[model samples]
Target: MSESFNWHKAVTKKWDQNVAFWSEKSRSMWNEGSRSGIIPFVKRYVPVGSQMADIGCGDGYGAFLLSEAGYDVTGVDISPKMIEHANQISGDRLIFKQGDLAELPFEQHTYDGLMAINSLEWTEDPKHALDELYRVLKPGGRLCIAVLGPTAGPRQNSYRRLYGEDVICNTMMPWEFEQLASETGWRTLDGYGVFKEGVKEDVSHMPKPLQQALTFLWVFMLEKQ
Candidate 1:
């Protein structure tokens, strides 16, 4: 992260400007084939009727899906415009709020499960963000976090090109993230990678090298211990 970078201002501006594009993209993906892998993983791991938080939930489509699956879901994002768009579609079991990931607005032990999909990679302080997530989760709460890994070269470059050097796309290595999780009182259940092209594959069972070579995103399932 750059010393002079204003993460909140920069991220907020970017998302506000692109919220319309993203809202449509999210809707299309949710309705089409993009969420096939994620939905299954969520169904298998997160029990029905659990209180869940979708951190960095842009446009709230993922939260909508989780609510449909019987989770009482709260979608949180830093972008006010994104939250506004999400609220327009909110229902009985789903709501959207504007909040920073490093300093979530909820009280302690508030959620039974949480997800941070494609979100943490842009955080200025991911460790603090993870700490906040740990603080809000009840004991044994499940967390499904997907982040951009180092291999997402094109995506990283795009951010730099569009935003400038100060706007960083911080990709984490698997081992680094695993260590952070361990230190933050989380027990890892599984770790895997998914490709950027939306291909449905079970690369979690493959070796680390092979997985890294093939995928751009890393997904981790963990339990708060």
Candidate 2:
């Protein structure tokens, strides 16, 4: 197999092994932060009753929040263990499925909006994954994505130490991320830095000097053109 495939496999295995730990941790804190940090930003662009996909939706907490907010939500993750836990909470308007970010299972133009919070950075090919997300979204649909930024710092280093050198994580500067969105046929509607309390729109696009000054997770709102 290719190096990329092996790296992805290792990442998936690591998540599978830690699903229980992550599930507990998510419920304790991460879920609450997401509700305050990203959910409201997403809701502003995607109205109720729209179909939405929560890509890389571990344990489905984010998806559940979107569902409760009135969207028909589908949560997808590569880890079967995560999907299994997610399915426990699934219902009429919420569906959880095991799937890869680079190859989403849905048909073209299937969703009105999609969110891939903290997930794309782990993909072997972020550009390919972005393309896949673009394909599945209906024309003019919105996408909200969050990924590790330059500020990932020690947390990222610790992952390499724990998961081995082959583990994949690709972080980009704010301008690079904006350019990627433009190249992939998505127009940047808004972008921000996500904090534990809420989202900040200050870091959307930055010069190299300013980019170097900021060290935080990035959340972007993009629209298909």
Candidate 3:
């Protein structure tokens, strides 16, 4: 299969067979990082009453948060399971749909802002996806993109390497990611390395390599040119 198809399949399988597991993990992050760190950062630039689109928005938790914050939010994901979960969790505050990130179904200039947290790394064509984002967003719309950095600590690395059995695809370094974003016409607005620390569910799975390397590195925010 093509790389893009393979990545899509991996996410599909995760949602179909392991939706609860991934949802719980994503939910945990929503409480601390997505709610407190990410949403606040995005809100700083996106004015109130703006229309926002959250691409690759698994389970729509982020979209729910943004809608609750007063943005007209539409969340889209590739996985039906994810969209279903999101619809169930979100109620009327957020709208959830299943769609491709690279070929969003929305019309041109549909939204005033966009958010793609931890979702770009899974795309086979990051540049194409960003171009679509540029098309859907209004002129000078703010975009906040967060992806799993190349150095996401030992535990995650170990889990993907061991239990995932190499099903994990690729992760880009910060500089490479920034270059791609810029080349795709996303202006670098304000960005910072966000670091998050957490232990595994079991003590036996803990790694003793804290501070051994940069863990959970992600760009905070950016904008469409």
Using lDDT as the measure, the top candidate is: 1
- Whole-model lDDT values for every prediction: 0.81, 0.79, 0.72
Clashes of each: 0, 0, 1
lDDT of 2: 0.79
Better candidate by lDDT, 1 or 2: 1
TM-score, model 2 to reference? 0.84
Per-residue accuracy of model 1 over 106-191 as CA lDDT, tens digit each = 99999999988877766778898898999999999889988666566635533664444675455676667888999889998976
TM-score of 3: 0.80
Residues 74-124 of candidate 2 have per-residue lDDT tens digits of 999999888988998956789999999988999999999999987877777
| Shift of residue 191 alpha carbon in model 2, Å | 1.6
Query: Which candidate wins on TM-score?
Result: 1
- Which residue pairs collide, candidate 1? none
TM-score of each: 0.87, 0.84, 0.80
Quote the lDDT for 67 in model 2: 92
Which portions of model 3 show Cα errors greater than 4 Å? 1-7, 33-35, 153-168, 196-215
- Tens digit of lDDT per residue, candidate 3, span 80-164? 8888888887445578888887689999999999998766666667778778888999888899887665457522532554453
In TM-score terms, candidate 1 sits at 0.87
